[model samples]
Target chain A: MIAIERNLVTPRWQRVALPIVSLVMASIIAGIVLAVSGHDPIGTYQQIYAASFTADGALTATFIYATPLLFTGLGVAIAFRMHVWNIGGEGQLYMGAVGASGVGLLCGGWPLPILIVMMALGGALAGLAWALIPGLLRAYLRTNEILVSLMLNYVAGLFMYYLIYDSTSFWRDLTSSSALVFPQGKNLLPSSDWPGILLGSFTLPFGFVLGAVLAVLLLALFRFTRFGFEMRVMGDSPAAANYAGMRTRRTIVAVMALSGALAGLAGASQIGDFGHVLDPRGLEQAGYGYTGIVVAALAMYNPLAVVIVSILIGALTNAGFALQGPTFPIGLVGTMEGIILFSVLGGEFLGRYRIRFGRAPARAPGLDDEPGAEVAP
Target chain B: MNADLIVSIAVSAIAYGTPLVLAGLGELLAERSGVLNLGVEGMMLMGAVTAFFVSQTLGGPGLAVLVAAIIAAALAGAALALIHAFLSITVRVNQIVSGLALTIFAGTIGLSSYAGQVWGVGGQHGVHQLVKLDVLGLSDVPVVGPILLNQDAFVYFSWVLVALVTFYLFRTRFGLYLRAVGESPRSADAMGINVTRYRYVHTIIGGAFAGLGGAYFTLAIAPIWTDGLTAGDGWIAIALVIFAFWRPDLLVVGAYLFGALSSLGFTLQTHGVQLPSEFFSSLPYIMTVVVLAAASTTLARRRIGTPAALGVPYVREES
Candidate 1:
C-alpha cells in the first residue's frame, strides 16, 4: 500500500517560501499583461502599497475591511479543519447581522453592556441556526452539505433585502429622505458601537484582537484537546473515526455550529462597528467571507496561520482601494488580490509532489494482483 | 385569491422559469459527464451584462442577445469551464476550489461590474425586447395556454431544449460513454474512452447553455442593462440540477417550480400583500434548502440519482 506516513517533521523553509516565489511570478505575469495594455505596472503597484499602509485613513479602512473577514476566516478555518465544507459563511454572517439588529431593536433601555452581550448572543445564535440546516442534513441524511450551505447564502441575501426594503416596519425608518432614498434597515444607535484600541502611531479595532484571541484559542484546542483530536481523526477518515467509537454525527453538527457562530460574530461585529443599518447591496460581495476561504487555505487550516493570512489579505485589499485614483480604477486594483490567491493556490503544488519528465509506465493487468498495491523496490 | 391572481402568478413563474430551464439542462449535461461546475453563476452574469450592452450598442434586442449568447455569454462561460477543465481534468486541482475561485474572479462584483460601468448609460430600454411567440390556436386556451403557449420564444425554446437534452442523455452512445465516465472514470479510461476530452467538451458546452440563460435574462426578462442583473440565478441553476436529480427532463419541472416560487414573492408585493416581502423574495433559497433536505432523507437519497465522483478530480496516477 502507498502509505502517507504520519511524520512529525515540520515543513521545510522552501515549502514556506513557495508562496512568496509564486507571488513574484504572478506579479511579473501581471506586469506583462499591464504592459501589453499600456499601463505602467510598477507605478500602479507602488501607489497600491503606499495607499494600503503609509497614507492617512488608509490603515483604518483596511482594518474596517478586515474586520468581517477576521471572524469569517476563523469560521471557515474551524470547519475546514474538520473537513466540513461550510460555504454558508455568508449566510451565517447575514443571520448574525439580522440577529444582532433584532436584539438592538428589542432590548430598549437595557444596560449598554448587557445589550451588547445580548446583541452578540443573538447574532451567534442566528448564525448557528443558519448553519444548522446543512449540519443536520449531513449528520442525518448524508446530503451534500456544500450545495445546501451555498444556497443559504443567497437565501440570506434575499432575507436581508426584505428586512431592509419593507417600508412599514420597525426595521425601516421613515424619519428621513436618506433612509427613503436607500432601501435598508434602520441604523444602530451610538451605544451599540465597538470601541477601538489606539496603538501609538496606528489605531486598530477590537475586532482584530477578538479575531487573534479566537485564533489562539482554536490553535490551542486543536493542539491539546481531545475534541480537536477527534475532529482531526474524522477529517482524515470517517471509517477510522467510527472504528474509534467517536460520536461522529454530534461532533460534525457541533463543529459546523461553531463555524457558523464565528461567521455570525463577524456580521454582528461589522454592523456594530461600521454601519447603523443593514444594506443587502452593500454586503453582496463583502468579499470577506470568500476572502476567509483563501486565508484558511493559506493557513493550511492552522488557526494561527489564519490570523497571519487574514492580515495579509486585509493589507492587500486596503492597497487595492489605495491604488484607486482617476487613472487606474479600483476594480482593476482589486484584481491583484485575485492574483495573489491564485498564485498561492498554484504554489501549493510544491508541498505535495515533485514533477518528473519521464513518461509514466503502463502497468499490465496482473501487476501486483493484490488489493493493496506497493511501490516497486 | 382570484383567477386573475392565479394567472398573474403563473405568468411570472413561466417568465422566471425560462432562464432556469436552459441553465439546468446545461448543468445536467456537465454533471452527467462527471464534472460539477460551480462557475455557472458568474458565466450567467457575464452573459446578462454583455447582452444588455450589446443590445444597446446594436439597437436591436435580437442581434444583441444573439451576440451575447454566442460571444459574450457562451464564450465567457466556456472560458471559465476551460479553466475548470484544465484544473480538474489536466492539472488535477480540487474541483470545488477551482470552481469557487473562478466564481470569485469573474464574480458579480468582478469583471462584469467593470464591464457594465464601461458600457455606460444607454442601457437595456434602448434595445427591442423579443416579441412573444404565440401558437395561434393554442393562445385562446385558458390557464395552461397563457402560462405555456402564449409566451416569449425563449420560453418555448427552454422546454424544447430540455426535451432534446433528455433524449441526448438517455438515447445516445455518447451519452452512455458520458455516464460511464461520471460513474467510474478509471474504468472508462481503461476502456479507451478519452476521459479528459469528454469532461472538457461537455463542461464547456454546459457553460454555453448557462451563458444563453444569462442572455435570456438580459434580453427577455429584465430587458435592462443593470449591474448584477443575474444576481444569484447561476447558483440557483446549480441547485436546480440537483433538485432535478440530474435528469434533463425533470429540469423543466424543477425550473418552473423554482421560477414560480421566486416570482411569487415579487407578485405578492405588487398585490399589496401584508406579508413581509423579504419572506417572498427569499423563497427560492429557502425552498432550495428544504428540497435538498427532503431529497437527502435516507429514502430520497437512494431514489435520487447522483453522478458518482461528481466532484472528484481525475488524476492519472503514474505507474
Candidate 2:
C-alpha cells in the first residue's frame, strides 16, 4: 500500500519549474560567458529577445523553423513514453525527406490534392521502413536500440548522400550548373501547400493544428486507453510487464513506427510549405531531431508537456537570430542552445528530489541491504 | 584493376588504417574501463590541427609529428576525458550526456575553424610531409617486400603498439586491475583496488592513444589540417571497438578494413571509376551501421562479448 501510494505521487512542481529555472540559469550563465569573451552581453541578450519576438517577420520565421522540431519532439516523446529510445529520428527524417522529395519530383504534372497525399504517404512509408529495422532488432533480437538507432543515422545520411551524388537517375538534375547532382523532384504546387490560418500578423499553418491535435490525442491515449496503460507499465519495468503477459516486443515496434511516422510528417510538412528546393542543405539544421530527444527529456516524456516545451524551444531559436552580429558569429547560437539544454537538465533534478544539507551521517552495516533508503544519520 | 592497383589498395589500407587502429585501441581501453568517450572526433581534430602547426614550427617530420601528436591529441583528449571522468565517476552524471556535451564543446564549427585559421595554412600546403620509413635491406625484395617493408614510421609503430597493448591488457597485473574496474568498480574497490585512480589513469592513457591516431592523420594520410577534418572517424573508432568485440588484437584487422573502405573512394576516383563519389564517400557510415547492427544481435553479442558494465557510470557507495 505504501509503495502504491508513493508510485501514485504525480510529479507536478517538477513538471512546471524545470524549464523556467533552466532557462533563467542558462541566460545568466550565457551573460557571464559573453562578458568574459569581451562582447557586450546586455546588448546581445536584448537583440536576441527582440529579434525573436518583437521584430517583424520573426514569429513567422520561428514557426517555419520550429515546425519540424514540433513534430520530431512529439515523435520522440511518443516512443520514449513506451520505453523505446528512438535516436534514429535523424535517419527517419532523412528517409521522410527522400520519400517526399521522390513523390514531389515524380508527380510534377499531377493535381494538387493527389500530389499532397502521395508525398505524405511516401514520406511516412519511407520513415516507417527506416525505423522498422532497429525496431525489429530491439524487439526480437534484444539489441541495444541506442546504438542501432545512432548507427542508422549515419546510414540514412549516407543514403541521402548516395541519392544526391551517385545515383543520377533518381535524384539528379543534369541541367543545374552546380557540381552537385540535385535529385530531381516534382515541385509542390501552391495549392498543395499546408494553408496557414492567419490571426492579425501570425500565419499559423495547418501543421500547428496537426501538432496540437496529436499532442492532445497522445496525452488522452496515455491517460485513458488500456493499450497506453500497458505501455506505461512496460516502460516502468519491462520485466514486470513481460511477466504480466504483455506483448512487449510488438508494442515496442508499434510505438517506434508511430514515432517514425510523426518525424516523417515533420519532413513532409517543412518541404511542402517552406522549402524552395530539394537539396541536402535543406535539412534546416540537424537541430530538430536531436532537439526532440532534449524535448522528451525536458518534458519527462509527457505528451502534453511536449507542446509547451516545443514552443519555448521554438521561441529561443527564433530569438537567437537577434544575437548575431559581424563580430560574434552565428555559431554562438548553437553553443548557447547547448548551454541552455545542459543547464536546464542539470537544474531539473532540483525539482524532482529535494537536497538537504548539514550531514553527520555514518553508514550502518546493513546500508547496502536497503535498496531505496539512505544510511542513517 | 591490375597488380599496381591491388598493391596501392593494400598500401592505402595500411596508411588509412594506422590512425583508425590508434583511435580504436584508445576507445577500446576507455570502454574497457567502463567509460565510453564519444569525444574521439573532437580530440582527433584538435590533434590534427595542433600537430600541423607544431610540426611546421619545429621542422623535421619525425620528432615534430611525435611531439605535436602527443602534446595536442594526447593532452587534449586527456583533458576532455578528465571532464568526462569527473562527471561520470564523481558527480554520477550520465555517460551519454557528458560525452555528447564534450563533443559539442570541442566540435563547434567556430572553435575548430578558428583554431585552424590561427594555426596555419593546411590541406596539402602548410607543413612538411612525413618521409616513408623503409625497413633496412628488405626494400630490395620483390612485390611483397616493397608493399610491406617500405612504409611510414607510424604504420610499423602502430602495429608494434597494438601488439604491446594486447600483451599488456591480457598478460599483465595492472591490465587485470583495469579490466576488473571496468567489469565492476564497486567489486574492484572493495577488493583493495583503487578504482578511481585506475579509471583515471586508463582513461587518460586511452585519450593519449586516440590523440596519437588523430596526429597520424595530420602527419600522414591527409598530411594537412582542415576544420572537422577527422570527419566522423572518432565516432567510427568507437563503433569499431564494438565491431572488433573489445579485443585489442582484432582492432588491427577491423581498423585496416575500415581504412580500406575509407580510401576506396579516392582510389576509385583515381582510376576514374563510374560509381558515384557520394556512394564511395558514405561507405564508412554504411559499413559501420551494418557492422553494429550485426554485432548488436543477442546471439552475436554473446559470441563477440562486451564489457559487463559498458556505458554505466560506477558509483562505489551506491552499490
Clash count (model 2, backbone only)? 5
For model 1 chain B, give the 10-residue run with minimal summed lDDT.
B118-127
For candidate 1, the per-residue lDDT at A184 reads 57
The window of 10 residues in a row where model 1 chain A has the poorest summed lDDT is A368-377
- DockQ each candidate and list the results: 0.38, 0.33
Model 1 residue A329 distance off true place after TM-score fit, in angstroms: 4.6
Interface RMSD of each: 4.5, 4.5
- Where does model 1 exceed 4 Å of error? A1-10, A25-40, A101-119, A167-192, A276-281, A285-287, A319-339, A356-377, B1-6, B58-71, B121-128, B136-145, B269-272
Native A-B interface contacts kept, per candidate: 0.34, 0.24
Q: What TM-score does the first chain of candidate 2 have? A: 0.85
Q: Name the 10 consecutive residues with the lowest summed lDDT in model 2 chain A.
A: A1-10
Residue-level error in angstroms, candidate 2, position B70: 4.0
> Candidate 1, residues B227-314: lDDT per residue as tens digits?
5577678878888888778887777788888888988967877888778767776778778888877776744657566888687666
Model 2, A1-377: lDDT tens digits are 11111112337776677677777887887677677666788887777766666789777767775677778888888887766878788778888888887787777657876877787787788888888887988888776676677667767776776666556556556565554443443345455565677879988866767777889998888889988888888877777789999998889998888889888877777666666345555473444676676666566678877877776667666665444445344445545565665665465434434534455345477734443222100
Colliding residue pairs in candidate 2: A104-A186, A105-A185, A105-A186, A171-A183, A171-A184
B265-291 in candidate 2: lDDT tens per residue?
898789888777767777887787777
Q: What are the per-residue Cα lDDT tens digits for candidate 1 across A116-135?
A: 78877888899999999899
